[model samples]
Target: MSLISTSSPSSKTLPILRGQHLHLWFDHEKTKALDDMNYAISENEFVAITGPSGCGKSSLLNLLGTLEIPTGGTLFFRNQNYHDIQDLALFRRQHIGFIFQSFHLIPTLSALDNILVPTLGNSQQKKDVTERALDLLNMLNLGGRSNHFPSQLSGGERQRVAIARALINQPDILLADEPTGSLDSINAQQVLDILCEIKQQQSLTIVMVTHDPAVALRADREVRMRDGKALDMTQVLT
Candidate 1:
């Protein structure tokens, strides 16, 4: 199992997420999708990963999300070595939140229920979970839409529900892949604003992948990738 010991503030100043010489290959492939990539993301930092379609940006996110393990190297969350963790599912459930471009909400559930989905595994009181979900939905400006189903909401509203669902678990890190891809420009900007606000209000550490330069420009740090390698291209905000 992964080590769960608490360290001093000195160590807390260390990266909240770090990849040590990460490498990945898919199913006996001749080429590696991620070639010995190394990255360190600090607590509460907003980072963006950008690249062409095949540049391994999503692979990097998968590795960081613990959905995929590296063929070589190690990924650490706080002080824990993820590959050493025995109960990965529980570990992830407790710590990581994900937002996908597709808005993966349950089709039959109302927006509020979709937001409450993650809390089903938790032992918190129902009132507490409902309160948390309501707070997030209201903050995302979807309070009036809570009773609606996924099909009844607009694209942006659906994505807001998806974002609320991700936050229900109160995760330490949020991973988003093209979160605004399907929205109109106004909706995209609205989603981006909400993301920034949440990061600031909750002190969240976010790692988002985007093809849009506009989205990349919104991050505190932008990392660009090409041919399975990433490089720090710009620091737009901090």
Candidate 2:
């Protein structure tokens, strides 16, 4: 990964993420998944990406989350050019948190263990991290289910566990891909409410990709994509 540090042109606002001319492609694929995309997300903002299948919503999220490098162009996180740095792994561990539709909880581990998984290796305040995880779980109404394994919990409960895990590290940004997918309508709304609440309570910056219109509506701004390009964009109050 590259690392270049520079403040945004408008320092009055906190631009936590910025991407310029981003183009990404898979090997042997002639078409680019993300083509010359440019966007910026400010601190404590909730931005949502919406589009039909294969519109590159997830791909864009991956790039912003630093899970993948752009084939061409640049990504800046906290005023640092991410591609300039080589320590991509450390960068992800320290600055990014991820949530997914599948929950991605370790099937073998209990809810508590799943929340503690990311903090297992690499350095952090262990006691504080563990306590924070528990606190998050409690806040999500999962306190009584701490020792329950993923298989034993309801779908909504498991996703709650995933959310708790993602926030354990107090990451600079949160990237969620279809976080409410694979759940019933009621459960999906509950998870969405929790996400909005977390963003408000912690002043967290979140970028989420969702196919659901209601879920997308919760964000402060929405970017629509089609054929690997951002189409129309708009902002709405949460």
Candidate 3:
């Protein structure tokens, strides 16, 4: 799993996302979660951010996911200033897929229903989302569990359903915050393999936060952090 390769560029190059000396403060005056983080994520690359707990890895992920805006510095997506974008919901729906460590599935919703949740209240997506959701369930090997609710499934199965939910929108990038952190060894490996397969099949750019060295080694590039800062710029994959 130590094998590493620079992401070979395609005939056409696209600037997917970039962060310039970013900063994030949980509390504007007291707590600073992220400090001076600068990184670039290329098209169709799998990049893992690894570090000790509370080192701002998740905060960095949140900023990249566009779920939280940085306190300072510039963030760009598709060459446009993301902080200035007026409609984040539309932007996220078009380009980003997010998976959290908690699984975050509604207790009352069935696996299929959970996966289709993002497509609701929208005429274009709601029109043909059933088939898409079903396909994702099948892809994640949860086809038989479609009718099962969160309480009825194992931790691994629930995470897989969450993954299906993230992918239901056919997003360009998938952001995962410690995706396999809650699973057993066998289940973790299964989830890792599925992520790799889907990344290749869908040509996705994945930015994942992981504490597991084995999991970090599987990524095309690894960025290490400490004390809410990126350790070095040269350590990143270009």
**How close to the true structure is residue 210 of candidate 2, measured as C-alpha lDDT?**
90
* Candidate 1 stretches greater than 4 Å from native: 1-12, 232-238
In TM-score terms, candidate 3 sits at 0.92
Question: On residues 83-181, what C-alpha lDDT tens digit does candidate 1 reach at each position?
Answer: 789987788788889999999999999999999988887889999999989998888888898899999999999999999999899899999999999
After best superposition, candidate 3 residue 6: deviation in angstroms? 28
Show model 3 residue runs off by greater than 4 Å. 1-12, 125-127
What TM-scores do the predictions have? 0.92, 0.91, 0.92
Candidate 2 residue lDDT tens string, 9-111: 6643748888778899987568689987878888888988888998888899889877777899988886689978778877777788999999999999999
Backbone Cα, N, C clashes tallied per candidate: 0, 9, 0
lDDT of 1 at 122: 85
| Best-to-worst lDDT order | 1, 3, 2
Error of 2 at 208 (Å): 0.6
The worst-scoring run of ten residues by lDDT in candidate 2 lies at 229-238
Clashes of 2: 9
Question: For each candidate, what is the lDDT?
Answer: 0.87, 0.85, 0.87
Between candidates 1 and 2, the TM-score winner? 1
Model 3 worst lDDT window (10 residues): 6-15
The true-versus-predicted C-alpha distance at residue 103 of model 2, in Å, is 0.7
Between prediction 1 and prediction 2, the one with superior lDDT is: 1
